[model samples]
Structure formats: structure tokens, C-alpha cells
Target: MRCPFCGHEETQVKDSRPSEDGAAIRRRRMCPACEGRFTTFERVQLRELTILKRSGRRTPFDRDKLARSISIAIRKRPIEPERVERMISAIVRQLESMGETELPSSTIGELVMKHLKQLDDVAYVRYASVYRDFRETQDFARFLGEEGLNEVLARER
Candidate 1:
């Protein structure tokens, strides 16, 4: 690593620690010539996973977009932020483990919906409504029927 102070290439790592992310390494370094200490972080770069959209377009994977969508579906709910973060991590892990560089948008949606179902029923319904693009209450009814939640909704209704 080049020293920012003197632009020297001679630097040594003084300390190394694992970052909170556990996927990254944090190092405290010193430029031997300038005696300046600095911190550096290193993380593994994964193969880029592209999301093939239903619009027939392709885009790079975006975690922020996923998080935002989940938050929207979970709005006004009692779900915690940590749980959402954990869910995102779990989804990413599944995608990565598949070792596919390109995946359909529907795959991502299904992964989100699967995990959401385990978290909260209302949140699951909310996510499904937006994700499945339900145009009418009947669409929700149909989804519940398909997912076998129809019997429960019927009892409540």
C-alpha cells in the first residue's frame, strides 16, 4: 500500500483485526519512512450476479434496492431492522451459493417471499401483494388460496 503522506510504497502492517462484517479485514498500517499510521480494509469480491428483469433487461445485483423493497413491504410493522438485515444476508447467501452469475428477478422475489412468510403473516401478505402485483382483493384471495392461507382468511372473514 502506498503511503498517503509521503507517497512511499514502503509500508508495514502494524495491526490486523477482523471487521464487524466478518467478511472484511481491517489493518492498521504505518509508513516506515513517514511514520504515519493509517487504517485499511479489505474484502472478498464476489462474482457479479445480474438480475434479469421481466422487462427483458438485465442489471447488476443491488442490495439497497432489495432492502428498500423489504422495508416498504414491512412498513408500519413490528419487524426489527436487524431481522431485515439478517433476511437480506440470508437471501444473498442463497443466491451466492447457487454459483449463477445471472438470475431471474422472479427468483429474487420468491426468495424474499419465502423468508417473509416465516416472519409475519401480514408482512408476508403485504410483500406478496406488491411482489405478485395483485390488482384486486380477489387476487389476494387467490394467492391465499394457492398458498393455503385461504382457509384461515375464510375463518376470519
Candidate 2:
């Protein structure tokens, strides 16, 4: 690696460790010429996965987009940032393990709902409002009844 401080041609790795999330490796390096030290992170890039929309259009699966949507639902909730990152990584890993390059948008939404349901009821409801395209209060009422969420809500109240 090139030294950032002195722009030296070579640097030696002093230490290496796996990141907390295990998504990347963190390396500590030293520039012998300047005696400068720095850290670098390395991550593995898997094959690109595509989203197969209902309209027959295809687009690359975007992790940021997924995070944004989930974050919206989780707004004002008590979920930890680490938990959110873990959830996103888990979903991506699950999809990648399926051995399919292209996946349906519905599949992604369902997975989000599954995780959200376990994380927080309010977030799940908020996400379901958008994902299921809920129209009226009756839709929520029906959802609560069908999902047996009525008891959970009552208990929380």
C-alpha cells in the first residue's frame, strides 16, 4: 500500500483485524520512510445482483436504497444502528445464498417485513403501509386481525 502521509511507494502492514461486523478487514500499516502509520479496510466484492421489477425491468440491487427504506420505517424507533446494519447484511447474505442473480422486488419487500416484524411492531406497520400499499384504516384493521397483531398491540397499550 502507498503511504498517505509521505506518499511513499511502499508501506508494511503492522497489524490486521476483522471488523466488528465481519464485513471487512482492518489493517494497520506503517511507512518505513516517514515512520507514519495509517489504517486501511478491505472488503470482499461479491457478484452483482439484479432486481427484477414487476414491470419486467431490471436494475442492480442497491444496498443504500434498501437501507434508506428500512431507515424510514425505523424512524423514531429504538433500534440500534448496529442492529440495522446486521439486518441489512443478513438480508443480502440470504439473497446471495439463493444462487439467483435476479430477484423479485416483492421478495425483497417480504424479507424486509419479516425482519421488521421481529424488530418493532410500529416499524413493521409503517413499512407494511407502503409495501402493501395500504389504502385505508380498514386495511390496517384487517392486517392487525389477520396477523394476530391486535393482541400484541393491546398488550403494549
The Cα local distance difference test for each model comes to 0.85, 0.90
Give the worst 10-residue stretch by lDDT in candidate 1: 148-157
Candidate 2, residue 101: the lDDT equals 89
The C-alpha TM-scores of every prediction are 0.70, 0.76
Candidate 1, residues 76-130, lDDT tens digits: the string is 8888876877788778878878889999999999999999988867778889998
Name model 2 segments beyond 4 Å from true: 1-17, 25-42
**Tens digits of per-residue lDDT for model 2 on 1-157?**
8999999999999999987789779899999999999999786657789999989999999888999999999998889998988888888888888889899999999999999999989889899999998999999999988898988878766
What's model 1's lDDT at 68?
Answer: 92
Index of the highest-TM-score prediction: 2
Candidate 1: what lDDT? 0.85
RMSD of each: 6.2, 4.4
- Pairs of residues clashing in candidate 2: none
Candidate 2 matches the true fold with a TM-score of: 0.76
Model 1: how large is the Cα RMSD against the reference?
A: 6.2
